[model samples]
Target: MQLQKKSKKISAIAQNKNLSIQFSLDGFSFCITDLTTNDVNLFSEYIFEKTIASPELLLEKIMYIFANDKDLQQDFKSVSAIHQNNLATIVPNDFFDRNNLVPYLKYSVKTLATDFITYDNLSSINANTVYIPYVNINNYLFQNFGEFEYMHHASVLIDKLITKIKNSSIKTGFFVNVAPNLMDIIIIENDKLSMYNSFSYSCKEDFIYYILFTAEQLQMNPEEFQLTFLGKIESDSDLYKITYNYIRNINFIESTTCFFNEDDDFSNHSNYILLS
Candidate 1:
């Protein structure tokens, strides 16, 4: 019998205590920062682009490079992978057996963030059976893989949103904006979550209808909650205009908790740019 040989190159950095890493396998770029850190370190950053035959190999190889760090060695809790199709997997340990993983996972999508899968939105997605909505829409209308992370980018954003939701302790009334292509929203409240709706439209009117439809499902009104928008810009396109245009007259205010970063320069498109 022959074994499959891994084919890949890797790079890594030991993030400062104040900085964590945000890597997009699709974009081939990684950004590190800690929101609570000092202003100087927060502003200074690094980024790079490269490809790997397998994204997991890139992570294992990079972790090997950072093996000297005691914190990464000890506190390493979980490993999760998100896929371009917006599906994700959460692994308990990096070295766990592979054959045991598939049956346990009914759906398979690659991951963006390496560890830290225990957070909110991801945890919900990880815990439940995610049903992908496949309608007869023409996929070719959009750019072919313009910047879709095979797994990790959206996972990272979901993780941050989950963290924000968990920490804020705000319940019963908040809106979350999401990208049209990714997974559907899972409303988190009182540490429990349930699927809200699924969509594939980039137009605000489409989203408004969807939201209204969701509200109808939940037996609520569109004017009752605050609105939060995600993925406002895709690389160079200003999508927020369309997003805001739909909700402009509503009394609901926008929430910054979903807008994790203020830096507009990050490569919002081209998921292939994420560094492995």
Candidate 2:
């Protein structure tokens, strides 16, 4: 398949070596990252969509490649790649035979990274020939792995980053704006415990509904737990104005920097945190 050249020139750090790519397709995102420096390279979020795969499997697949590659072990201490719609077919052939990864595949998969797994490796589908059409394509199709993969990477990298910041001279909580696709409130404090809640909704009304639901559950006013909102907002987005109005007294900063810029050392990226 022909790939479209990206025109948007986002800033990136110049390096001595070509960067390694990592792709992740778990959860609600198709994400790509440059693992060399914990930099998020590319991502696409699938709003209000769900997936059958777990996020851990996506990381394992990419990490497996990184672990197996000799050059990646040496000069490149990190891995990077983008998760796109192709993940339905991107998993490697051996992934089906690994057996270790089999338990994870609760359902039959039509596509592995390079080749198609046989009918035995897949779950029984109502239609026998459904996935036969996409047997040989290298590019991903019909899957939204990019957003979730990016989130998985971000969650892991950000945990380490929080430690780095705590160790640094900075004294502030790391504010993060997760894409709606990976809309979860997992609190990875100290990178040890995974604690967080999931919030779901499509528009501002839905967001408000979820917030109200949270408020009702906590038995506190909506304002009690400081809330912050982030994502791609057009100039006329009502949420932008509504959020500003609700949290007028509090601080709300745009979180574009966390998306990854080649020139940054991730030091300036800490200020984008949100807290109550």
Quote the positional error of residue 57 for candidate 2 in Å. 19
Write one digit per residue (lDDT tens) for candidate 1, span 227-271.
554432342343445544444422222233221234434322222
Best by lDDT: 1
> CA lDDT of 231 in candidate 1?
36
Q: Backbone clashes per model, in order?
A: 29, 37
Whole-model Cα lDDT of every candidate shown, in order: 0.36, 0.34
> Which regions of candidate 1 fall more than 4 Å away from where they truly are?
1-28, 33-84, 88-159, 173-184, 196-198, 202-205, 233-276
**Model 1, poorest ten-residue lDDT window?**
133-142
Per-residue alpha-carbon lDDT of candidate 2 for residues 1-276, written as tens digits (9 for 90 to 100): 111122112345334333323232322222333445544433322222233254444444434443443433433322333232221211234344443433333354433454432222212111111121222111231131222112123333334444544465533322324333333332223432232243444677664455455446645444544443433332245644554454433233334345544454222222222110
Model 2, C-alpha of 110: deviation from truth (Å): 17
Give each prediction's root-mean-square deviation over alpha carbons.
Answer: 13.1, 13.0
